[model samples]
Target: MNNLGRNLALWVSIIVMLLLLVDVFQPGNTQHAAQQLAYSDFITDVDTGRVRSVVMQNQNVSGTLTDGTAFETFAPQDPSLVSRLTGKGVEVVAKPLDQEGSPLLRYFLNALPIILMVGIWLFMMRQMQGGGGRGAMGFGKSRAKMLTEKQGRVTFEDVAGIDEAKGELQEIVDFLKDPQKFTRLGGKIPKGVLLVGPPGTGKTLLARAIAGEANVPFFTISGSDFVEMFVGVGASRVRDMFEQGKKAAPCIIFIDEIDAVGRHRGAGLGGGNDEREQTLNQMLVEMDGFESNEGVILIAATNRPDVLDPALLRPGRFDRQVVVSNPDVGGREKILRVHMRKVPLASDVDPRIIARGTPGFSGADLANLVNEAALAAARLGKRTVSMREFEDAKDKVLMGAERRSLVMNEEEKKRTAYHEAGHAITAVLVPESEPIHKATIIPRGRALGMVMRLPEGDRLSMSKKNCIAHLVVAMGGRVAEEVVYGKDNICNGAMGDIQMATRVARSMVTEWGMSDKVGMIAYANDDQGGGGMFFGGAAKNFSEHTAMEIDSEIKRLIDEAYDQARNYLHDHVDELHRLAEALLEYETLSGEDIRQIMRGQPIERVEVDETTPVNRRSSVPQVSGPEIVQPGDKPENDKDEGGEVHPVPQPG
Candidate 1:
């Protein structure tokens, strides 16, 4: 009704403006059209008896001439004008001064500017108010968007790989569906459920699934939406949001990235953000304060749960914190199948094999991988996505897209081949090292070449021997370069390899306590854990002597790996030459190709799909050698590590 009234007023004002414009611009009727005459001409005509009749109002005069022509003129102060006209046999009438023109039209003309100014001011005010409470003045309103049924519904079936999280949230669905079941036994549904995990682990997806299963209103918002630039706005928004939640009882409220507003109070060098702190305080009060919010379940998600305020995670607030970590082999296979349903796949496209190759992929990453494969098939104008397309997609995702356009000279190509051949041979011979999946002298991203190794399956832990094998594989490129081109010709291509080996060795001595000389103690600082950056800074817990011992152990570990790599390359010099030569000729070799070359058997490169070319050589030139990609055991460099690796049993 308010909108109707406003629109009606707007239309009426527009019509009125149109009428006024027409009144001002309308052409006069032919009979009433009068020629404007000068005062002197009018007087001359009156003196000559040419005037027929005159109507006078103040100093303005209009009349019809003897010839029946109408005319109007402004007369000067002539006191005898009317008497003279009567004496000259001219018919005369007088009009009052106030009757000079249409009174309403004159009054409207005087007030037009004022009226237009007022209208514009009112329009601006209405715009600022946003009519429906969504403008500058509506900052206090909550931004939570209610997800209606019209918006695509996502159920538990759509979500895969995080079954444990789904199971944990199932009770909430049950509570919303039949609250009396738990209430009859004097049990109240949990106040809130906190979904905590790394990013892209299906936390938000789980929340939506719960809402879909329960068949209730779902109000979704982000933590940053609650706090704004204005003071007291966040608190007001919190109150508004809860009021909305209360009205939509039996509904679920999902807040993504809640750490934005729920950080620990009074935590900063300068001081805590008063607005954010107040918002957090208001949220805490509403969750478990004097009044209860019945039938309203609040679900929040954050990857950084440690930074949240304790008040927000108490029993009455977010009573349960469900961890949604990355999926295992079975879960990954399920996730892949779920994503694969959207793409047409060939009979040989096995989800299990793809899952095994992708060790640390999240649900989002799996979906992306499937999409990339489908796109690759489309690029080739193929009817269906095949296993070969999936393999190329995986390589593209792990390493970058193949730079077949990057041309390389013969010498540089040979050097890159030998560098990668070093890694492939060391990984194949080392009993504890993982198997080399593929080796390519083709430039990818910033690296001239890369050797990719895949674990047999998911790796849950690493052993002492496995760490040593990783160090040796990391040093293999440098060792091969030194052996083939001599120490004097060794290039800066080993920078990445050296960094990887050093990090692994340092972790072994400092964090994993794998060093005998450094003793079985964790000398590394936990700077990233609990209260990160805000309160985690402190001096080294160990003394100078212990630090020295740790440094010495790290150096000793790397030096041993380097010597081991050199000796192994020296022993298998002939095999190294064979693999390098094959790489130079073929450009890229899969696990089977590498195995065949190492066993002194010739390989037949057969085309799986004639539509898409395989193992194309680079036509563009590159100036550098190959670099090795290492797998980091720590979370900091998890994604860069690409995939996981574990010890593979040696063949008898």
Candidate 2:
């Protein structure tokens, strides 16, 4: 029954029961106003002819007196009592004495509490079981959901940017389609396939594509689904899930984020989790144990394959491990095409150009880029998404949304303008440094102004010259401020630059072995074990004296870069002033504009909106610019720091 019906029935039954209980306890009319009399007094009244009428039912006797009074009494078991009442001309009535009461009613009243208790217990059990026969108290049942053909069907065609991983899984699809072909050659399909990669790389999507191509049943679940607070529940669930897979042979069972339960056994703090370990053990047995699961394929995905137990990744279990890395330039272009199919694009929108602009982006990130562009176009009441919108969206994703409402005084604005101009000029002059793409004093995210520099193409590794050039470019902003506003007048806008420079210098000294004094020795700590402060961190790999050398080398690198940057700015002081003035006038300058200003030519500015500054002849014409660096009130030394304008951190 529905909940409302069940509740109504229960309330009705309870009301009946309460009434029955009240009736059984108080067996007479509560509203009666009758006085009690002694047996002798009742006899005297009947004998004196004062009794008007009498009614008797077993031991209870009630009657009215002749003087207009009402009374009730119990008489002794005497035969003459009735005869005396008749001789005195008194009316007498007798009712059948239900001696043992109703046997059925009495039985019902006696067993009501036990009956209600049993009914409530059964109801609770049904609720805990999720009102399904397969749900055994809801804890031991498999939470894996069966994905049917009609429900959000995804095929290999829908997946892109991970062709190698897709090709590896295609064999599984073939095996499921025609198992006899593989069997004829005495080939056994992989029992389990583990997809290892960073998040948003489309591991789970690949699994769904496998199911779609094979046209087989897909049962999807999560690793955490197998675990619960209660001990042994996870194991039972594992067993049940495999049993379900067995019932639907030639099916794909996807467990996303398997590392949750498949982490190395007994390697955590306070011993370990008994429930999770037990669950993992049961899963291992089900995968490649004595009972062969021939037609069922297990697919699991996790970013942290390092922490997974060795047993889980052995030859028998997870026979194939596919690495789904970030898409390269070609793959990214293909991925952009896949996501672009759903959006309305203008004539100017070029997927290839957009792909080239976004480096280190995953499939999910590309999808979000397209969505953000569509949203921006829609917000502007445009019919289709344009290249300009795509560029704006990319900027928003990389840097952050613009904070145009922010207010800054003239002094701070001029300081920010010079600081960013310093970064742009240095980057342009340095041979190995990347070309300056844009420079701006407009606020974005947390920065007050920034100068953005984009590489000519994708760079896999950096040379020693390139590294030193980066350090010089990092210190340019601080040097510019110092030269323009005196030694003590420089603000704290270079903190981010300093931090970035220091990290690069330390890595060069300790990790990359670029320091001559360190002599090509590796002293960096390995974080693959996932150890940190809570895990007591890793021990120092190098001795105390070696560590001192490393710190001294890092400081030396920074000092040299700062001096070099200061010299460059001092020599080209006129170009720096011109760029800073152009930024202050236009509020933003593209690469072409910066070049025009450097050559003593006026830039043709086209204002598209309140916040966007467009250069018609620019090579890159989007609203994309540099990171915003806030000029802090604090004073610092003649060194650089950092801000959001450096390298963008790719979101997973």
RMSD of each: 9.5, 8.8
**Overall local distance difference test of candidate 2:** 0.79
Worst 10 residues of 1 by lDDT: 619-628
TM-score of 2: 0.78
- lDDT string for model 1 (1-652, tens) is 7646776787688668756764665445225668999988988899999999999988889999999999999988989988889988999989988636886786577667757876787667646433434633466788889997656789999888888888888989999999999999999999999999888889998898888889999999999888766678789988999999999998999999999999999887663499899999999999999999999999999999999999888898999999999888778879998887767766556676677767678888888899999999999998888777887887777667877897878888888889888888888888987667677777766678877776555666778888899889878888998899999998877776777777788888887878888777877675556332322346466766777888899999999999999999999999999999998888888777788888999977654443343222222111111111222221222111112122221211
Sliding window of 10 residues with minimal summed lDDT for model 2: 628-637
Query: Once superposed on the true structure, which residue ranges of model 2 sit more than 4 Å away at CA?
Result: 1-136, 268-272, 526-538, 606-644, 648-652
Instruction: Give the clashing residue pairs of candidate 1, or none.
Output: 406-620, 407-620, 407-621, 407-622, 408-620, 408-621
**Candidate 2 at 53: error in angstroms?**
20
lDDT of 1 at 70: 90
Q: Please state the error at residue 191 of candidate 2 in Å.
A: 0.7
